[model samples]
Target chain A: MSVFIIRRLLQSVLVLVVMSMLVFAGVYAVGNPIDILISPDATQADRDATIRAMGLDRPMWLQYAYFVKNALAADLGKSFAFNVPAIELILERMPATLELASCAMLMAVVIGLPLGLYAGLKPKSFAGKTIMTLSIFGFSLPTFWIGLMLIMIFAVFLGVLPSNGRGATALLLGIPVSFLTWDGLRHLALPAFTLALLNIALIIRLVRSGTQEALLMDYVKFARAKGLSDARIIGVHVLKNIMIPIVTVIALQFGSVIAFAVVTETIFAWPGMGKLLIDSINVLDRPVIVAYLLIIVTLFIFINLLVDIAYSLLDPRVRLGESDS
Target chain B: MSQQPALSTATPVLQVSGLETHFAARNGIVKPVNGVSFSVSRGKIMGLVGESGSGKSMTGYSIMGLIDAPGKVVGGSILLDGREVRGLDAESLRALRGNRIAMIFQDPMMTLNPVLRIDTQMVEAIQAHEDVGRHAALDRCRAALAQVGIASPDQRLKSYPHQFSGGMRQRVAIAIAILLKPDVIIADEPTTALDVTIQGQILAEMQKLCRESGTALIWITHDLSVIAGLADQVCVMYAGRIVERGSVDDVLDSTAHPYTLGLLNSVPSRNPRGQRLRQIPGMTPSLLNLAPGCPFRERCAHATRECLEDPLLEPVLGHPTDAASAAHQVSCHHPLQTGIST
Candidate 1:
């Protein structure tokens, strides 16, 4: 297992290097940094001084080497648009995005899994049929559209919860780990629910199919023949078998949950990385974009690794070292 | 062999009569179990032999109350030791299953959870139906494992179902079934996936356990040879109907109905050794498009004009061992007789 993890880590390092190089080359190829140096406000002498100071006058290869070297040392360079260190800006925005994704995922599993299990247990019953239809609609509708619907309903029609932002009042909780609105769930309810609604729909579909398939397996029949009650049969036998697939689906989608939150954050003005990254792209903040891309990629790879480890824990048949048992 | 039908003799542990199960589909209803009737006394092993789609498995499921969705028992009287089980509530039925009656499926893995440890699953199974403590349940689980011929019970219990080979999985499954010490056990082709040697061992162990514990057993399978060796009474089903039923020797040797005779002759051992195996001519008719008359008439060699009308089970000719209540009964207009040619 340790050997497998070490190999995976080595492979990840190689992949990260290759990906960084590609992004660096593509960004460099798009334009000349000297163009940014030679602004309309600058005279020829000023432009020359600026180009030399920023090392933009150097050869492309030397410029790339310096960029890589500085990036490695955690100096992501000053963003042309923001006039601040790119790494520092990304780090400032990371917590809110992580908070939203984490809360949404939590909401997805808690709400969706139970609903799916209930539907699976009584497929022919009235409740099961209702849940199935709702999920189909949930899965079919677009996430952003659902988010808009939620805002229209809770914010506009209901007039109960706040539409957006962290909170009007200071939170009692020490140092918010997630979005200020979400960190204080009392205020965080609306935005979190808005983000969570689509994920819940997705998770419901995944868990429903997984549970339904597991319920039909011979082991389930065997468990029933053991005279196990319907609840026990579903909880222990069916749920356990269904979890492996559910975990994978949830893990694989976590990165997308983070990426897709851009639209939601923009609409609500929720100060998360999604909004930050999009704003950076609009102004063409090169350093910020690079840093954001690397961070998102790293998070995705880390989540996938966590899922792989979880797979071995769930089913012993899957040994980490060998492809085939 | 206690005579006088009374509650004193345990009321024939499982008495099934006029069991009619049909599948209601979009096309039409398919009547798979048409008035099937049988009774299994305590300490008795009744073998239900049938070909594919003969409703043997359905009958087993019906007894366990495991039938769900499209299929249902339209008409039946399932009595477990004189108590009616046909209309019992779900809770009552669940209580009865596994505690008083247990079923073993063909695939052993069906009975064993692939992800769970043997000990955990078995102990849970034990604790589910009984209020026994964990340590006591664990001890019982260990003993049950050892009883099924598993070596080093503790280590085997700790291992997952995948760690064990096919035969061993079946043994573990058998152990789980017997762990509850149910009054009745329905083994539906439990040994079908096992090796011949392992099959023999399992059969021997199962029979011994049933005999010793006085647990009534309904062994449902297509393997007539296994039934011939293990069963006390043999009920032969053809297209969901029990065409012939009697003692194991009587059904295997005499084979009064043409379906039974054909089924017997179809097997390699019963046929002439050097000659090509004689198979039953036609396939089982689809239940949806079944003829109004006998379901097996298309496949029976002796099917005649009279066979157009459904034939109730009747005594075979020249068997005057109590004609009113003979040991053998065959469902055919023309059963094999003293001078009737094959």
Candidate 2:
């Protein structure tokens, strides 16, 4: 098992090496950040000095080598907009995004899994049919559109919650979170729901299919025939089997949940990395774009490793198989 | 035998009478188990033999109350030890399942959860019905494994289903069924997927276990050869109905139903080399398109006008044995008789 993880970590390092090249070349290839960084009225000398200071005057290969070296030391150069290390800026906002994405994930699993399981259990029941029909909107409709509608219903008209922004923040376990207070939670509800809607839809579909397939399996029928209670059959037998796939789907999509939070963050005025990315994109902020790409890509690889670990843990066959290999 | 019928000494461990399980398909209702009836006495193995789609497995499922949506035991009295199981509520039925009545499916993979360890799954099966502690359950689990001829029960229990060979996994499944010494076990072609030698071993182990525990066994299968040496009694099924039933020797030697005769003739036994195996003429009649009369008349060698009407199960006259073996019965308008030529 340790060997498998070490192999995975080494593989991740290899992937990052390839990714560093793409990030350096790709960010430099796009629209110039210098256009937004300095005034148009500035003299050629002033521009030259700024370019030299930022090390843009160096050959592309030399600059890429420097970027790789600094990146290895956990130092992404200063953001063109914020004038702080791009990674520091990312790390500062990381907590908010994590809080929001995880909450949305929590809501997705809590809400979607049960509904899907129930739907699967009684495919012919009216409630099952109703849930299946309603969940389509969770996937088909746009996130920005859903966010506006939620704000309109819960905040503008019903006057029960805040419409935008992450509410008053407090530290929990040394990490600042927006959901500690009632006001914060109220503010969180709509954006999280918006971000969670598609994920909820995806999870529901995944669980429903998983459950339906599991129900037909010989083990399930055998369990039922053995006179296991409906609760135990569904809860222990069915749930345990279905979880491997659901966990895989969730882990594979966690990075996307963070990546796709852009629209949800913008509409709700939530301060997360997604919103930061958009601001950086608009100004053609080179360092911030480069940092975001590298972080998200690295995160993807790490999450895949976690998924493998979780999978083997859930089913010992994988764990034992890994040892043999 | 703990839950054996209190009212009568004659009460069999499982008494399925006029069992009818139907499925509502697009065309119409498909009768998967059409009026199937049989019984297994304590310490006896009753083989339920039929080809695929003959509703053999459906009969087992119906008895276990495991049939789900679109399929239901529409009419039947499945008396497990004289207790009516047909219309029992889910909770009541659940208590009886895995406790007094257990089932083993054809695919051991189907019977065993892939993700669960053998010990965890087996113990859970017991604790689902009984309030036994984990330690007690584990002890019982080890004993059950040892009973099924698995060595190193302790280590095997720690292993997952995938770790065991197909034959060994099935042994674990059988062990689970017998863990609580259930009154009846409905085995649905449990050895069909196994190799010949493994099948023989499992059959021998299963029969021995039933004899030792006085647990009635209903082994559902498509192979007459598998049942030949294992089952004490046999119930031959056709189109969801039991066509011929009797002591295994009596049925095998003096088979009355043409369907049974056709099934036996088709077996690839010591037939002459280069000769085609004799087969029944037609496919199994579609349940939806079935006519009013005999299901096998189309394939039977001797079909008469009398066969157009459904035949009631009649006592077979010539068992030529002890009075107990004379309980043989066949459902046919023209059962092979003393004077009648095929």
Candidate 3:
């Protein structure tokens, strides 16, 4: 088991390095560093110096090698436009998006699983029909439209909650994380629900289908014949069998949740990486963009690794040294 | 033998009467089982023989209350110990299923959970209907495993279902069913998938166990040879209804229903090892779009114009065929008489 984890972690490292290099190459191909430095109005001498200092005059391989070295050392350098450390800017905005995505994923699992199980176990019953209809509505509605509707109901009409921001204008517990929107979860009723509601619908349907299929497996019939109650049969036998695929879908959705936070943060005016990324993109902040892309890629690869370990744990039929069943 | 009250001397442990189960489909609702009746006494084994889709498996499922959507018991009763069991609720039905009447399926994998260790599954099955401590349950599970010819019970119990071979898995399933000493066991082709040697061993084990414990068993299969060896009584079914039934000897020997005779003649038995097996002439009738007449009339060579009326089962031709065949019954308007007919 330890060897399997070690092997998986090593593969994850290889995956991240390959992804980072690709991103670096793609970003470099778009435009030159000299464009930022020698704005058409700059003097000839300043342009020459900026080009030399940024190493734009060097061969592409040398430039990329230098970029990789500085990148590995966490010296994301100053953003071309923001004139601030690239790492610091990205970190500043990451918390808000993380908080939103976390909340949304949590809500999805909590609400979706039971709804899915109920739908699968009792197809065509009253509760089943109600859940199915709601799920359909949840899936069909656009994410942004739902977000807007929530803002209207909770912010504009009800007036019981704040429209946006991390929290109260002041810091709590004497610690300023600078990601006010994350602290704003105390007032996150609308944004979190908007982010989660659609995902919950998607997950519930997936879980319900997986559960229904698992329930039909011969082993489940075996468990029932042993006289286990319907609840026990579903909870233990069905859940364990279906969890591997469900975990995979949930992990894949985790990436989307992060991406969705971008639009959500912008709408709510929350200080998360999505908002930060968008703000940087509008002004064309290079270092910060590079840092954010690299971070997201690395995080996705890392979570995928975690999912692999989770799969091995859930099903003993898979092992590093043996053939899979 | 003295004249004795048949009910007192030979009360059946399970009596299924007029049990009709129908399944509704887009085409229409078709009765898969129509007015089938039979019984098994204490320690006796009854084989229900039929072709696929002839409702033999459905009968077993009905007895176990495992029938789900699209199908339902439309008529008749299932009585265990003279108590009606047709309409018991979920909780009571579950209580009775694995406790008093257990079923072993054809696929051994359907009787063992892949993820769990054999010991965990076995012990849980035992304690599901009993209030026993873990240790006692485990001990009984071990004994049950040993009883079914699984060597070194302790070692085998810790292994998962995947670790065991197909025959071994079937033995484990049979062992769990026997552990309860259920009043009636419905084995739906439990040994059909096994090799001949393994099948013989399992059948012998089941016969010994049931005989010793006085547990009635209903062995459902399409194989007549299997019934010939294991069952004390046999019911021959065609298109979801009992075509002939009697003691195994009377039914297998003093043949009545043409379908039963066709089944017996079709098999290349040891008695006629070199002879060409006689094949039945036509396919089984479709459950849907069934003709308004006898379902087997198309395939029965002896079918007559009277067969188109859907004949009711009674004393075939009103003839007292055999003194020993009083209990024997055939559902045909014209049953073949004894040696003179053959």
Among the numbered candidates, top TM-score falls to 2
List the candidate 3 regions with Cα displacement exceeding 4 Å: A32-42, A74-78, A81-85, A168-183, B1-9, B268-277, B289-292, B315-324, B338-342
CAPRI class of candidate 3: acceptable
**Candidate 1: regions farther than 4 A off:** A30-39, A124-129, A168-175, A178-183, B1-11, B272-274, B320-325, B338-342
Model 2 chain B scores worst on lDDT over the 10 consecutive residues at B1-10
Candidate 2: regions farther than 4 A off = A320-325, B1-11, B318-322, B338-342
Q: Write down the TM-score of every candidate.
A: 0.93, 0.95, 0.90
lDDT of 3 by residue, A214-322 (tens): 8777677666666768877888778877888889978878877886578878787777788887876665566777788888887887777778778777776555535
After TM-score superposition, the amount by which residue B230's alpha carbon in candidate 3 deviates from its true location, in angstroms, is: 1.1
Give the interface RMSD of each candidate.
1.1, 1.1, 1.7
Query: If the candidates were sorted by their lDDT against the true structure, best first, what order would they fall in?
Result: 2, 1, 3
Sorted by DockQ (best first), the order is 2, 1, 3
Consecutive 10-residue window with the lowest summed lDDT within model 3 chain A: A174-183
Candidate 2 lDDT tens digits, B21-57: 9999998989989998888888889999999899998
Better of 2 and 3 by TM-score: 2
